[model samples]
Target: MTEIFVKSLPLKDVISNLAEAFDTVYFNRCQEYQINIPEKYGTGFIRGINFDNGFGLLEYSCSFKESLSIHFSVNNIHPLKFIYCSEGTVKHRFEETNKLQTIDQFQNVIVASTSKNGHILLFPRNQKIQLNSLEISRKDFKKKIDCDLNHVNVNLRKLFRDLNARSLFFYHGNYSIGMSNCIDSLKVNGLDGFTRRLFLEGKSNEILSIQIEDFEDDQKEEPKRRILRKADMIQIQKAASLLKQELHAPLTIKDLAKKVGTNPTKLQEGFRFTFGLTVNNYLNKIRLDYARDQLMLGELNISEISGNIGISNKSYFSRLFKAAYNINPKDFSKKIKRNSSQQH
Candidate 1:
């Protein structure tokens, strides 16, 4: 909510002392949120109870010439942190009490707590370093993706590192300005509150998608080969049609599969193969498309649209509709109305 900027402050003695002083004051106000950065060692720490309001604030201390250790701790309850490193290589120690590990220069690190403690250490290359922390919650996270987390972690790190490396190389080779300019853009163009929350949610899903793509690329598992037979496809189609007709009703995959004279697994496989999307995906697409059509008629608001579509959660319904249509439901409806007026 509040942005504080400090420029060219003394890093070694003064800045560290200031950080220590601030930590003492911050901890006293709210026992739930605690921060400690010792004056002797070039390190910092932050802890928060809930990520609802967002992560606790911190004062970054770094010398333009010295390499500083920026220590961060997120309790197990807090969601993953998407960190964008602006300058220098950051070695990250994933969970609490783990060996010191490093995420090389120009990379984004996703830190999640497996148990109750998660931590990260940033080793700055230059005194002038910039970074943005986007806090994400597990509840708002969606992983419709079908890959194991352990399998995806390594691949994700590699993919991000590769992307950052390529981007940096291109910028340095072709652009007039250097890496500093790029870092400035990244830090300054940081998202506003709503967008930052959305970005965090999107990034989590993006990570999962990357893992799914990795699996698809490796050819270790093939969906086409495991697709259902013609008979099973027919059953799935029938079930899908029935579900489509009853779009205003609450339908479960299990019940739908049973109604089609098949089990859930076979139905899911067949539906996915036949439609090129998961059963839930197909169902949502149908619902949203129907909602769009109704909105074009200019007869209902979002709440009514959600209710008529058998989705009780209006916010979730809006999110789903936006995800499907590439525009928010309200905006899509407004555009439709504007187009109608133009036609008239």
Candidate 2:
């Protein structure tokens, strides 16, 4: 098993004086990648920014060793990128692109790029990139902008190209500041996944509605809008119900969506809007709540409780339980038992 180290810092508090912080968190539990933190200066400086709902924005910069290669796997569906650069430079080569391009210092702008090839090369001499990884689903994004996915992609690409074509635009010759400000607003005003789904869906529909009004003014055909009807709401409710019922099963978004007769994307949006939780978060809450109930019953050991909750790996279960409850499962059970005995 390989382990990857993760370090996160809050930037809103530390960005004034250009201060830097560094540390390494152990990752022996992850079986995927063995991440090595070289004894390099100023490699893991991160500042955290809170977004709307439970989402978080992280800004960080790293300087890699000459010819040093780091390898890791990524969940392909989620969108990821390094959108802004304060200083220094780095070249990224993806399996999809043969050429390596240097992303230089661009103040107050967001750069949107994808990493399908899973390889990024950081130049040695103090390379810095202010990255904002928006953990938004493709479906939700479409709803927010009230455009089809393909059209949205085309428009976004055009936006990026327009920004790049100009040496200087608005304040910083880059559109990153505008995008970042917009994201900040979304993070501050948007609801949690559950609430955001409804908000985004409504917003998207509203955009299409406005577009329709414009078309009417121009005497053109109205554009078709992808609105979530009553059936869609019912399907989302059904999926949430099923997920709640099968708390101990390996519930996947795909499986839940299929069972409810909807696609994964819509299922995700609907679940978030209807339940105020992502599918995985909702399921985990179910499992954790069940585990708590079992602990209170005093009939099951920690291992048994974990197993019954469908967390087959005892150690992983313990860690997860601790992360959620702020105590190890065994200790939590003991505390419950002690309290029960005292009450009697």
Candidate 3:
């Protein structure tokens, strides 16, 4: 196992310290600091950006050649962290605790060590892990957003107000789909320079809000109305698989819900929550994506392609295809043919 110990404050120094450990240098652009894993170590990258508001983001998307553990032992108050495991498993524990927590896919943990206590993160070798850490310096964050914590949940409000790190805090929950989407947006956005920084800051604030809300919902006495729980996520995945398997003969929302052992409303809610699309729209997307592939093959007419995907109306299919791809099916097919002939 490879172990890297860090005792740095603020984020830039942390990234620099990590880079030094990896035998590589970190680059900074528009306040974003990033480092690629040295070839001798593994593959992929670790990047982070800190905002002026004391909230910062650190992302790890890498596969190490060997097991690794990073120990953060800053001798002062550490930042509160909202860590999400988007892809592989990650094990975490407080520096002073024996109990270890494993964060699996789609799971998140909110952690804050007691004053001067530290945190340890373990990454298994050969696993392509994608993790994000949202860090907040409680003292700085409180100064920026210091207001009546009346609207915040009692526990979280207290956590936010613990600027001195008077108590340790840890909570684990499945992150909301909204938070997932927001994080994705942060990674894939095209903005650059000052604009990118502003966009990231805005999204960071949005994500923090979502985290607080998810924690509050998880704390609810009766969570029957929670549509994004682990059980619901499983049902949603089942529903999606069903949709894809029966794309040519899509089921009604009620029938699909029945197959998934959920009500139509909850099923729809699940779809919206997990996929950001209603059932019908998601089905349409499936159909359209399939149609685009068939069109690219240049073997089937637009009507046949549409029919094969369960769209009966030729004109309606054309409209949906146009709306989705910004070009009519016929034109898309012709363009494909033209390109094929030109290559020949």
- When sorted by lDDT, best at the front, the candidate numbers are 3, 1, 2
**Residue-wise C-alpha lDDT for candidate 3, range 1-344, written one tens digit per residue:** 99998753577888898999998999998989889999899999988889886889888999999999999888799999999888999999998799999999889999999989999999999999999998898888887777768898999988998989889899988887778888788779999889988998899889888888888887865324353554467888999998888877899997998888767767888888778999999999988988999888878887788778888899999999999999999888899999999999
Alpha-carbon shift of residue 340 in model 2 (angstroms): 1.0
What candidate 2 gets wrong by more than 4 Å, as runs, is: 1-230
Using TM-score as the yardstick, the better of models 2 and 3 is 3
Each candidate structure's count of clashing pairs: 3, 13, 0
Which stretches of candidate 3 lie above 4 Å from their native place? 227-231, 239-266, 271-344
Pairs with steric clashes in candidate 3: none
Candidate 1's residue-wise lDDT over 1-344, tens digit each? 11112111111222334345444433532222334544443344433222232232222324323444443332324444555454444565644455665543344444554444445454553444444344444433323222344555454434333311221110001111122233344334467555644544444344334423433333334323232433355687798889778988947987887787767766777776678777888888889888998888888888888888799898898889888888988899889989989999
**Overall local distance difference test of candidate 3:** 0.87
The lDDT of each candidate is: 0.50, 0.47, 0.87
lDDT of 2 by residue, 169-248 (tens): 11111222223334334335636544654554344334333322322222322123122332367677777678767766
Steric clash pairs (candidate 1): 63-127, 64-127, 91-102
Which model is ahead, 2 or 3, in terms of lDDT?
3
Q: How many angstroms is residue 163 displaced in model 1 relative to the true structure, after the best TM-score fit?
A: 61
